[model samples]
Target: MPESATLPSATTKLEYLRKDLEDLRYYLDEFSAFLPLSVIIVNPQGFILDINQAFENLIGLEKAGVLGSTVAKLFCEQEQFAELEARVLKGEVIKGARATLLLRDRQISRSLYLSPRHDCEKNIIGYFLGIYDISENVKLTEGRNGTVCARTIELEEKSEDLLRSRAALMNILEDVAEEQKKVEQERDKTLAIIKNLADGILIFDPHNVLTLINPQAKEMMQLDESSVVGKMAAALTKVTNIMPLINFLGRNIKKVYRKQLELKSDKVLEISAFPFLTGRETLGKMVILHDITREKAIETMKTEFVSVAAHQLRTPLTTVKWSLHLLLHGNLGAITAEQRDLLMRTDEHNERLIGLVNYLLDVARIEQGRFVLRNKNVDFIKLAETVIAPFLEVSKNKQLNFKFIKPREKVLPVNVDEEKMVLVIENLVDNAVNYTPPHGNVTVSLSFDKAKSEVLFTVKDTGIGIPEDNKQRIFTKFYRAENAAMASTSGSGLGLFITKNIIEGHGGRIWFESIQSKGSTFSFTLPLK
Candidate 1:
C-alpha cells in the first residue's frame, strides 16, 4: 500500500462530517413540518435557532425573519421566560406554563411546554419548545363566569315576582270565597221566606219548566214538590188540581195579573204572573197565588142582604107610586091647581124610588148567576132606532146636539136577548142626554164588523169626564165617580154595573175611554152568532 492511502486525509474527513450535518438538518425540518403544535428550537444562549410553520403563523411573522432572534424577545413575560430557560438547562421539563406571545400589532395568550435537547454524550445543548394558543379559551372561561353571575341575578328577580303573584292570587281567592258565602246565606234566607210565606209561589225557567215550588204552593195545589217541580207546563196540565190555572195561562204566561181562578166550588184564588228580568233580558217567570175565597163569600153575603132589603121595600114603593099617580091625574077626586102641582112632584119622587128598587133587584139576579138571556136573531139597527126615538125629545130639551151614525148597509142583525138589549140601549142613551152639558155633542154610532161576525155600538158624549183616580171603579156596584157624584145627586151609581152584567150575559164586551176634563167614549161589542 502507498503511504498516502494508508488513512484518509483530514480535509476528506471534514467534507464527510459536513455532509452528515446537512442531512441531520434536513431531517429535523421534515419532522417539525409534521408537528401540529407551534414549535421552536432555542440555542443554549436563548436565541431562536429555527421555527416550524405553526410558530410562524402564531407570531404572524415569517420563519426567515424570526431566525436568530432572542427567545425572550418573542415573549412578554421576561422573568417567566428566564425561569423556564434556567429550569430547562437544569434538566427539568416544563409543561403548561402560561406566557404571552408578542405579535407585530397585538399580543396572544399561550401555554408553553419546554424540554431540553441533548447531544449523544447526554449533555444539554438547546431546548425544544411547544406552544398552544389559549386566548379563545380564556375569553370563553371569563364569559361563562359572567354569564353564571347574570343568570343568578335574573333567577332571584324572577323568584321575587313569583312571590308577589302568589300573594295577589291568595287575596283574590279569599275575596271570592267570602262573596260565595254571602250568596249562600242570602239564598237560604230567601228559601226560608218562601217556605213560610202565606201566599203560594211557583218559579219557572224560560223553557216553561217548573224549577221551584214553595211549601205554600205545594199545599195550595195539593201536590208533592218532588212530583210537580222539574215538570213542564204542558206536562203539568194533566194534574187535575192545577189544570185550570195552566189552561187559563195558556201561552200568555207573562201577561196575567191578579186574575181570578176558581180551583173548586169552595176555593178561589187570585193569581198573578210576572217575569224575572235582568236588564232587558227575560230570565224566567214567577206565579203568585193568593187566596180570595173569604172575600168572595163576604161579598155574596152583602149582596144577599141588599137583595132582601130591596125586595121588602119594593111592594110598598109600588103601592105609593099608584096612589100618587091616581091623585095627580084626578082619578080619586078633583083637586086645585096647587094641590095638583104638589101631587105631581110627589109622583115624580115615587117613580125615582121605584127605579132604584128595580136596579137593586137586577144587580142581585146578576150576582146570583140568574141573569138568563133569551137569544134571538133580530135587526139591531131597528132596535137601536126605536130606543133612540124616545131620547130625541129629551136631548133636545137639554139643548144638546145628538147624532146617530149608522152603517150604510142597514139591517145588521145580532143574536142577543131582545128585552135585555133594549134596556142596554135605553140606559146608554138616557145617560148621555142627562149627563151631557148644554151645547155639547152626544154621538151614538152602530157599526158591523163582518170579518169578526160582530157588531160594535159606541156612545160618545162630551160630558163631565171621569177623574183619573176614580175611573177604575166606574163599572163597580155602588161605585160613583167623584165628578159624577158632584154633577148629580140622583144617580144610583148602579146603571153601569147593571149594563155591564147584561151586556156580558149576551156574549158581549163593554169598555169606556175617558180623559179628565176632555170627554168620554163608551163602546161595546156583541157577537152576531
Candidate 2:
C-alpha cells in the first residue's frame, strides 16, 4: 500500500507542473496578440525576463535582443530606472510613468504601467510592465492646440469686421436723422408761407389725393378747411367742374404756370402747378391759384401802358443816340478837341442810360418767356480770360491783383450759350471787384472733371463778403447786402438774379460760399459733352 501511494503522489506532482506551464503559455499568447501595447516581465533584481512582440516594436529592439537586459539599460535616463526599481522593491504598483528610450537614430517616448508580482510566501518575485507609444498622441494633441489657436484668431478678425459694419450703419442713421430734421423745418416754413400768401395754395399727392389746402384756398373754393383737409379735389369742387384742374395736375409736364380755369361761380382763376422734388424723388405737387379777375384787368391795363410808353420813348432815345454818334465820330463836321471831348462825354452818359434801359428790357423778356439760350461748344478758359481782361486793367488801377488760372489741358468743352456765359462771368467778377477793397485779389478759374461730365467756373475774391443774415436774400431782385450797399451804391442788385436765370436756362447749377470779412467764391457748373 505504501509503494502504491508513492507512485500516485509522483504522478500528481507531474500533472500540476504541466498545467502550470500551459497557463503560462496561454497568458504569453494573449499578451502577444495585444497590438500597440507592450508587455514586459522582470525578475526581482530588475532584469528583463520576457518581452512580447509589441514590446520589441515599442523599444525599436527585438525580443531576443532585450531579454536578460537590465531595465536601466532601456531608459535614456538612469534616474527613471531608479524610480521603477524603488517601486518594485516596495512591492507597490507604479502606473503611467513616461520615459524616453534611446535608439541609434531617434529617441522614442513611452508610458509604462509597472506592477509587482509576489509568491505565496509574500516574497517579491517579478514585475509586469505595460508600455504604450505616446509620440503620435503628443503630436496630435499639439496639432489640435494649433487648430484651436487659428480658429481663435479667425473669430477675432470677424469680430472686428462686424464692429466696423455696425459703426458705418450708425453713421448712416445719424445722417438720415439730421436730413429728416432739416426737411421738417423747411416744410414748416413752406406751410407758413403758403398760409400767409394772398393767393390760394393747394398740395396734392401723386394719387390725386388732397394732402393740404391753405386757408385762402379753402375760402376761395367756398369750402371749410376741415372738410377739404383729407377729401379729394373732386369731392371738394363738385359744385364747380374741376376737370381742367385735375388734368393740369395729371399733366406729364414738370411745371405749368398760369393755367386759366373758369369756375362754376363765374370766377376766373389762374392755377400754377409746381412739382416739389427731393433729389430724384418727387414728393408731391403744389398748386397756387390767383383770383385773377381783378389782377387780370390791372395787368391788361399795365401791358397797354408799357407798350405805349416804350413806343413813345424809343423814338427820342434813337434820335439822341444817332445825334451823339454823329458828333463823336466827327461825321457831321470837323470840330475842336474840347467840343469833341464834351460830345464824347454826352455820348457816354447816353450809353449808360441805354444800358439801364436794356437791362430792364431783358428782365421783362425773361419774365415774358421770350428769353432763350443758344447752346454751343464754348471754351470756358478763353471766355474767362476775355471777360476779365477789362476788369484786370481796372483792378490794376485799384492796386489789386487779378489772376486767371486756366486748366492744364483742354479739359472738357461745355455746351452753353457763349454770350450768356460771358455775361454771367462778367457779372460775377464785376460784383467781386466792385465789393473788394483796394489791394485785394480777384481770381477766375476753370476746372473740369470728365468722369462726372461737368465743368466748374469759379470767381473768387477777397472782398467784403455777405453776412449770414443777407446771404440767402442776395440773389433776390433789388436785394443787396447791408455792407455791400454801404460800400457801393451804384449796383442795381440784379446781377445774381439775372445770372441765376441764365444758368438755370442752360440746365446748370450755381452756388456760393462766403464768410463775413473772409471773402467769397461763386461757382457754377456746366454739363460737359
Best by lDDT: 1
After TM-score superposition, the amount by which residue 162's alpha carbon in candidate 2 deviates from its true location, in angstroms, is 56
Error of 2 at 523 (Å): 1.5
Residue range 66-100, candidate 1, lDDT tens digits: 87678988889999899889999889988779988
Worst 10 residues of 2 by lDDT: 166-175
TM match of model 1 to true structure: 0.66
> Pairing residues by index, what is the TM-score of model 2?
0.49
TM-score of each: 0.66, 0.49
Clashing pairs in 1: none
